[model samples]
Target: MNHTDHLLIFEPEMAGHQPLYIRLLYHYLLENKPTLKVTFVVHPDINKRLVKEDGIKLQTVGNKINLVFLNETEISASLHNTLWIRAVNRWRLMKKYLKTTGANHGHFLYFDHIQFPLALRLPFLPEKKISGLLFQPPMLDFYGDEKNLKEVIRNYRKKWFYTLMLNNTALSFVYTLNPLFPSYARKHFTNGNKAYHLPDPSMFPTGDINLSDEDCALTKHVGENRKLFLLFGALTKRKGIFEVMEALKHLEPEYISQIAVVFAGKLEAGIRSTFLDKVDFYKQNNPNANLHVEDRFLSTNEIISLLQYCDIVLAPYHRYFVGSSGVLLWAVGAKKPVLTSNYGLLGYQVQKYHLGISIDTTKPKLIADAFRRYLNNPDDYERNTSGMERLHAESLPENFARIFFSKFL
Candidate 1:
């Protein structure tokens, strides 16, 4: 239980990109950091799902990779379950784990949930060498000359939080997925030098990915000549599903005929009926629209298969979306182009890397116009080879691991 040459990775949630992030880090440690003893602390449900059902082969990797299942709710006790309560409870779990294992360093895979509590209570906590990966830093969302009262208050509050969190002597480093935020942080905050840019990993399954019958069937609908525009991952209204459908209405039949739109991944239960109804209505109106829906959870391999099959990746996120996206990285990894929102960090990256077109996704006409331009000459919008190479180099899973362990190693 007492190991000085050890690092503990604490993660609770398993949905969305959590599992992929953990797998990438875990496998990286096992392969590259052979001498480092690492312990992964996750929820009991994740233990049952990832270890037992998914067969990640952590057990086969010998004792170097320690799997510890700690139920997060146990730490919460009988406290009224607010966000602060939950954040504090998670922090308590991490502190206890660090104390129990005598780990030299601690890292949080997803720390945005617990950051405020940790910042406020770090003085009380005994841990000295702890770091966390921040996916969404509100400071990055602040555009110049804020006029809204509520927005100004929120921005100032975030600034205060960042000031406390970064200036704390206990924190070794705060890793960020926003590659551009580190410079801004260093210039603005007192101890912002600790802000390190951890590349958002874009790597996906390549070579011969085992495709299912359903996967094969999904690709068959794209036919021979038409370009496929794919909107992958969890389907929610915020993903601009309605905007896409409305945009399709603006395009001419000939334009719609040349392109196919596929809504892949599980539709949010709240909007499933509405989404299906829209799809049906679109089909009824434009018979040659060529729209397909794989309304369920897609495996990593299946997603990669789809990525390889598709022509353009649609990432028309809502205006409020400020964080980096896994979809953008997947598009880059696949050497494909994306039509994303020109609002926040996503817009900055697409424009910086020349990944594809960035526009105001709120307007259906803009989305339609982007499609028309791409359809006119797909080669004109294709991501450059150098751009893809640079993005890939920066976003490799190995870089994510290296930067994460920079303080410890």
Candidate 2:
């Protein structure tokens, strides 16, 4: 096991989330195993908006890790073949390095959020030996609306190409993004090992933002009369915000008035106006439905403050919600109970840690019933949070690295 020669290959430009995991793992390697080489082939998307200390920044972390921000678009134009821009750059970048260093053998570790798409061109990359960390396989059906022949052909290509990569690739280790991923991936990678679960460490506080005043203010908004239900993260269609609204409406006006629904995160395109419009409608008739909506990206402290002050954390993701959730981990760390989808990893964690309710978010009746039941007896779920104490200990960065390395078998 020549750990020094290993390459950590990933595109740290998908969102604020992708780069965060890389930074966390970089620190882990920096402190414990300084010999390992870490290379970040970030896309320009990162350079534009997400440069906050919380986002991925190209600062000097360690001598071993190389931060290579190549012109990914350059490779796209260069390749006449139908290969995607990311894969083309990944191949070109590695080929350039291999040519320069004259190194024959090195392990490639792929831990990208979009793992399956990389398979579209992995065979073209130079590395002979490869491994991957799949928190969740890309749900192809949920990818887009156009299920035409072109999309179907692309889907078949992904499967065929991925099968080739898996047979040649040394190991394909699966992790629970949600409970569905392990089984979901195993159906494809029969030889792959289900890895020990690893939590996202960025969920831990940076200790930079003091949320004492913020938490006090938020709690004061809820007052002595209301239970706060919080939906945190970048608002998206898959997050089931509309379904949650439907469920809330199913409750009697009295129950609705007693609860405060706070949507705290950057709203997706076109969702802000609709969300606010619905919120206004709800507020006009049911003044008791104390709605506190923050239509912007949440800072780290804001996330912490939401978890600290809220009575319940809302997940309610769709079938597209495979693998683990960074948002859920924050709520768990705060020891706040959650009301999430019972389908996959959310259900597992909710059961494992006694976090809170996990019901089918798509079924309005079920969502409403869960909300009603939870509202009727909040302490029943609150009492279950004692299980999370062990999870906090288990998910430390050092512990994650130890477990990650132990998956070598």
Best by lDDT: 1
Residues 245-312 of candidate 1 have per-residue lDDT tens digits of 99999999889989889998879877999989999998998888799998876656667777889999
Predicted structure with the largest TM-score when compared to the true one = 1
Superposed model 2: Cα runs more than 4 Å off? 1-8, 14-16, 43-58, 70-122, 127-129, 138-164, 170-190, 193-199, 205-224, 270-272, 380-382, 401-409
**Candidate 2 lDDT tens digits, 1-409:** 3233545454534443655665566666666764545565555555343454355465446566666664756434433244355445555555565455433332233344224334544453434333445554443443222344754675566556555445544334444333344444457654434333555443665336565574445455575677889887878778888888777778898788678888877777667788778778877877667777676665566677767778888888975465577777787788877878776566676777777777768777788787777778766564364677666555565655555545442
Deviation of model 1 at 147, angstroms: 9.0
- Candidate 2 backbone collisions, by pair: 177-323, 177-324, 178-323, 178-324, 178-345, 179-344, 179-345
Local accuracy by lDDT, each model: 0.77, 0.60
Any idea how many clashes model 2 has?
A: 7
What TM-scores do the predictions have? Answer: 0.84, 0.75
